[model samples]
Target chain A: MHGECCFESEVLAAVVECRWPERVESELRVHASGCAICADVALLAVALREDREVLKSIAAPPESGRVWWMAQLRARREAEKAASRPITAAQVFGAAATAWFAGACFGASSDWFRSEFVRLASGAESAGIGVFLTSGVGLLLLLAAVSIIILVPAAVWLAVGKD
Target chain B: MFRDATLRDAIAAALAPADSESGSLVESQDVRADFAMDEDSFRSFYDRTARGLWAYLARVTGDRQAADDLLQDAFYRFLRAGTEYESEAHRRNSLYRIATNLARDARRRSVVRPDAVVSGEDIERVAGADSAGSLDLNADVERAMSRLRPNERAMLWLAYAEGEPHVEIADRLGLKVGSLKPLLFRARRKLAGLLRGKDSDHAR
Candidate 1:
């Protein structure tokens, strides 16, 4: 029942056109004076129309060309991101495979690796601090592993940044 | 809308095959390849809707600066949206919906709205220089509208400010058409009461 009036649209149309009580037909003005919904609609519509005008005076939306250019730039950037996804994935896979191959080669190279693997577990547990650093070969391998972990991503990022 | 003749010319220049020696023509062609609407069509659409859309954003967010950001964003998203429109009205509705959502998201991200600078050229000066009552009413309505919920403001605005149909208003706000009437009624009633209260105060 609320907000429902048979004359609501007629009243609304008149208000939108700035006719309302002043210029509308005598019968419609009489009805608006009596109908609660129509009266409220008129009051609200006039106020909002004014507010909209005020806002229009204040708002200066950017030029369409600037908007268009920004959209194009964003689209191109997104395209670059989309195109690089497979390359990024491949980079990660390549790094992992290299690490795995290096591990397998180290495992296969010497009986010393088997003994050292056992020593590594016990040495890491008991002789914690200097265990790897004390062994020259282990120290070299540790530094190499650390360097790759730190460097590969940085290199890729630099490469991407350059592009 | 077609007022930005300079920018339009620049866009035209960029889109045209001039200065091919720099290969910029090829780059611009690639840029156009992914655009949702061509240059002329987009210019026409922007000319038609930009002011209304800007006003809507300004009112809904209660900030002109935010409206600037949201207007550009809405158009960009609209272009990127790439949804086929059945008509100009449909496309306009789509842009409104996008703009509404963006305004909602912006309000959520920043709980405190930036103070909108109501410019020196007041609406009263432009709209009602001769009628003092109308001037007071405009300012009063502005203050009272700030008291409504954003959704309520949006509803009232789309309904009365834009003079949108119930169906278009419903679509723009993503509401069921049946429910929009009562909701609009409550919002209108509240706004009317607030406006009357001001009128009485002015009378005193």
Candidate 2:
């Protein structure tokens, strides 16, 4: 196997440092030139090390401060979103509850609603949609309840966007 | 350990009822309160590792733009991880590991293997002042490297470019040392063959 050898590391070091076959001792240089494994190591190591040096020399990563502040900004946004989640949930819950309660109150106060609901419950061929349309206050309250159901989530969506 | 002390505190405050997974892209806020490295420490670490990490990413992915994006992502994820490290080397390993996985995922997500934009102009342009045949050598390297598997490129680069040993390479690449030797050997041989083939083509 061209994989294991005691001198592979030394040859690799000399090559990486640009010392192989010249700056290093003649004995090692001769060995590296002669041994297949050492020769392969020298070839690849020097090429890669040179490439690495060129890359580092030419490449300029963004300044550390910029990266830091960007991270901080992102973390803050994440935190704000996290904080708003429960609040949003509570808002939706509250809106739904209020809509339900207002509908219940409107139904309890309206004689027309009681008569129509009981008629439907008794499986009677009761008055159709036009009857509820005529029950003015109850109709208004039901419309308001439906509006709240539709608008609250729309408001939350508008406020939060799509995350 | 954070000198600022505000980041995690803010996260903790916000995430009080935090396990709310509803439509959340950031999987869990369970560890939101625990970033161990402070801003100063993070800044210092970024300064130390960014260049090297960028080079590693650029070479492995063959996309400098992807490398740039992934580099920032790696640092952010590292900070967000809130992991406490035992040593500087450990921290580096963790960062590199995160970077490696991100690059891997990015590659898998990419519909096609990204073209090797690591051109001769980048490498030989620097060594242009130095030895003879530097142009041909660098071009050959870039060409040969593009042909290897990403893991192979990573192993060889870590070994030669970063001068990391087999054990550390294995750890960073998520391979056991026992399995790494053969794989590294095979990769190195493939690389040598490609380089040799290039030489022969020129000779012909």
Candidate 3:
């Protein structure tokens, strides 16, 4: 739309630069009619414009509504899927933390029991039987501790995952 | 339904090509403000733009199936981006940018596969004529398009097929406006030569 040599610039931009036009402007047509250089530009632009229409005509895509519906459904599903991942991660972390807390508590309680048993056994006149009992009890506590540490969190995590 | 129609009108106006010299930045801002956070709004927007976008994807990738998958991915990423744009053109450009990047990444992940065999019924449908000649020509055009590098194909399609201005095409393709001209020139010349060679082969 610029006057003088800017017409050539515009024509060049339209013809060689972008090689497309949504619509040919009358001003450009007028200028091209007057200028030989722009005349060739105009011809090329017109041919390209025709080619654009031909390409468009050849392209018959699937229905817009159908594509849109599929996109909507996909977006919803993806959002839902993305929302679930963080929750799953948090659940796993929560399960592990809970297991560690439970183990610590079980270990502390076992220590208390062992200390009490030792205290009582040390103060006993017949400490051999008491020491044997303490050893037996300590073994049972260790087994209980191992079982709780291994089984409880596995059960909790799986149950949470199912939900 | 009335409210939905009103929303659709608003979005359409927002996305309509800029009319004023200053561009539709202000109008688009107003439209973005009204962008409904519901599926219905997004669906309406999709209805307005999907076919052209899908056709562009199909043209660029030369695989209808990849187009289908990429179309969904493009829209999904657009919705997730949640960007406020200066104009409808800007939003559309952003969508194309996303689509271009996705297409490029997908192409990098896997080599271009051979074209699927076109069933007679499908070819007939595409040709809309009984002439097998037109079907062959259409297939040839697609094959020729596939031979171009992905970015070259995109630039050519955006320039000649989509009628996008250099500035918009540059924006979508992440190229400088000044650089688009020479690139487009080369692409157009190559395409013209391919078409000419195809015509000559048919003459023989």
Candidate 4:
């Protein structure tokens, strides 16, 4: 390996640079004519140069309009998908607050309704009919509050997702 | 932080009432206003550069489908950024920079994926399939390229394959202009060695 022909390796560096004058290629060709290794290096350079062209031809990308359109479409789709996932701190906080409010209202109303039912059934009311009417009205108000608390935010969330 | 900004823009774009999907393709008032590049300008830019960029990507990644996906992603990100370029070359360089990063990231990801491993014979067969043996040069080129580092492949491709000047390659790859020449020279020398060593083995 101490006697290795520098042209055998140097020709490759020259070819890779691709700035070699015709004189350089001619000299390399002459040197290659007498040496097998140099010839291989020269061949490699030509093959590489030719390969670039091959890549250019084969890698015909999609049409400009198509590429552009697809990019826009993809961005929009990804954006929409990202928007749908509720992971942001603000979004998480909003959801939590909505859940808590709904849970509190439902719990309080259910507790009151349970107590009212027990009292009404045990005949502990001075005005039994009036008490029943009041309890019925209270239950309706609770149901309305629960519906608003649950439905409004759910509607808002769905609308946000759509947007 | 960059992801956060991208995420924010993406969310904003998503939440806007879409004018129409098809209509949005040619001209999006939202994108145009943000980027300040009208439909014609973008179309013109795309017409001039997309194919070449795609070619660069394909050679770098050695995968046509990956090139396709990256090409789209590159353009989408470029549009999303909305940065004003002083000139077409600057814009082109910026696009290539985005593409280079995307291809690099894709390569990194593929290395981690279990199924990304392909046999040497399979790669050769696929590379050889492009054209008869005349284009078979790419087969060897791709084979040799697989042996090099990703950045080496990129610098070599941009310098030799794409004919980009040293300064431009530097900017695109985030290297200083002074360092680009030596780096590119080293990459070329290394690739030449890889090509010789690998192909010689195949010949035997």
Winning model by lDDT = 1
TM-score of each: 0.77, 0.74, 0.58, 0.62
Candidate 4 or 1, higher DockQ: 1
Q: What is the DockQ of each candidate?
A: 0.28, 0.26, 0.11, 0.17
Question: Lowest summed-lDDT stretch of 10 residues in model 3 chain A?
Answer: A46-55
Report the C-alpha lDDT of model 3 over B94-164, residue by residue, as the tens digit.
88999999888888887434363233556434433534655565565566676787788788777755667
Model 1 chain B: weakest 10-residue lDDT segment is: B17-26
lDDT of 2 by residue, B83-109 (tens): 899998889888999999999999889
Residue B165, model 1: Cα distance from true site in angstroms: 0.9
Quote the positional error of residue B158 for candidate 2 in Å.
0.2
> Candidate 2 or 3, higher lDDT?
2
Worst 10 residues of 2 chain A by lDDT: A116-125
Chain B TM-score, candidate 3?
0.72
Q: If ranked by lDDT, best first, what sequence of candidates would result?
A: 1, 2, 4, 3
Q: Judge candidate 3 against the unseen true structure and give its global Cα lDDT, from 0 to 1.
A: 0.61
Worst 10 residues of 2 chain B by lDDT: B22-31
Q: What is the lDDT of residue B120 in candidate 1?
A: 47
> Residue-pair clashes per candidate, as listed?
0, 0, 0, 0
Q: Model 1 off-target regions past 4 Å?
A: A100-146, A152-163, B1-31, B111-114, B120-138, B200-204
For each candidate in the order shown, give its overall lDDT on alpha carbons. 0.75, 0.74, 0.61, 0.65
- Write candidate 1's Cα lDDT for A27-145 as tens digits: 88788778888888777777777667766655577777667766776665566556667767777677667667766766676587666667777888998848867988777766766
Tens digits of per-residue lDDT for model 2 on A1-163? Answer: 4367689899877776767666888888778767777777777887777767666665677777666656755775677678788877777677667667766877776786676567444433466666656667546756776876787677666555646
